[model samples]
Target: MLTKTEVVIGMTFLVLALLAISVLAVLASTCLVYPIAIDYFGIDQLTGLSRGELIKNYSVLMAYLTRPWVNDLVMPYFRASREGLIHFAEVRRLLLFSQLVAISCLAFTGFWLKRLQGLGQLHHLKRWLLNTCAILLAFCGLIACDFSRAFILFHRLFFQNNYWIFDPRFDPVILALPQGFFAWCAGLAVFYLLGQLILLYIFSIYKEGQAL
Candidate 1:
């Protein structure tokens, strides 16, 4: 049978895994972490502008993403995104920490499942993990349904100020970013997390079958 400590460690790791995946989803949507991030921040013939004008302005817009200091028009916009850039760096740190936690949890959980026998208690633990996944998926579903409201609410809960709210004239990059992409990323994160839970649950079942 698995001890209380073993079960706690496994459950704790699962929690961290969920958090890590969720963070990745946000980073991916921000296009800061994803390679395709630059693709998400461009405009073609923006309102009241011809194709040539859009292209001319887009050249500067692209600069805000890469080396903003070299461009004078978007220097202020680059400065404005500084706080958000710091937050993104912190997110990378969080992702690293969460990955470490997930690895530790997976190691302990795998050890208990493989090296040890008589883990009848793991059945209950599996059920508990399933319940936790259900709750997380439900929350993700809510966010998926009304992403704009949820996104705003999420920012309100996490961010202290309204710095995220950017004007198109100041930071066109933010305007270029679509809310739908964020919604899709959130859904993808939840699905990825659900897959992890399913894997754990299946492993428990497979182990049980082996015992029989």
Candidate 2:
């Protein structure tokens, strides 16, 4: 049997892994949705850029966000103020942090799971999944209710400055990327997280029943 401390540590690792995976999912969805959102929302017309130009610039932005070595964001058609650039830099750091957390927690969770399996305690994972799912569902619901406020709150929580508030005159890229696009990204992330957790929950139940 596991001690209380061991069980708590295991659950903490599981929860962190789940949250990090969700963050990664949202970032991936953000990249994938850029082109679709641009076309669907008539961003080209709004920004006075051709479809190809918009895609090219947006691609550069996404590449900068994902690649650690790319230190500067150079969009051909868009210019960013110092504050906007700083905000993007901060976003890149946050993404890298989330990726690292996901990798480390997942690796640790693997060993923890192996230990649990040896002790016939793997079924305890189901409880962790259920509780995390409930919390994530509430978060998704809150975002769905008023995403604008949630978006601002998210920036405030993650960033120490107000650099995220971009001026359209300086950062035309914000015009291409609308709040609705982010809302879609959030929805996709929630979908991915919930589906993953529910599947794990079912598999855990199956494993428990099999041992009976």
TM-score of 1: 0.63
Evaluate residue 168 in candidate 1 and report its C-alpha lDDT on the 0 to 100 scale.
63
Model 1 — which ten-residue stretch has the worst lDDT? Answer: 71-80
Task: Name the weakest run of 10 consecutive residues (lDDT summed) in model 2.
Answer: 26-35
Q: Per-residue CA lDDT of candidate 1, range 8-75, in tens?
A: 76667657755675555444454342234334434332234334544444455434433424423343
Number of clashes in every candidate structure?
A: 1, 0
Off by over 4 Å in 2: 209-212
What's the CA RMSD of model 1 in angstroms? 6.5
What is the lDDT of every predicted structure here? 0.58, 0.84
Q: Which lDDT tens digits does candidate 2 get at residues 82-151?
A: 9999999999998888889899999998898778877888677887787888888887788888999999
Q: After superposition, how far is residue 67 of candidate 1 from its true place, in Å?
A: 17
Query: Which of the numbered candidates is closest to the native, going by highest TM-score?
Result: 2
Cα lDDT of candidate 2 equals 0.84
Best by lDDT: 2
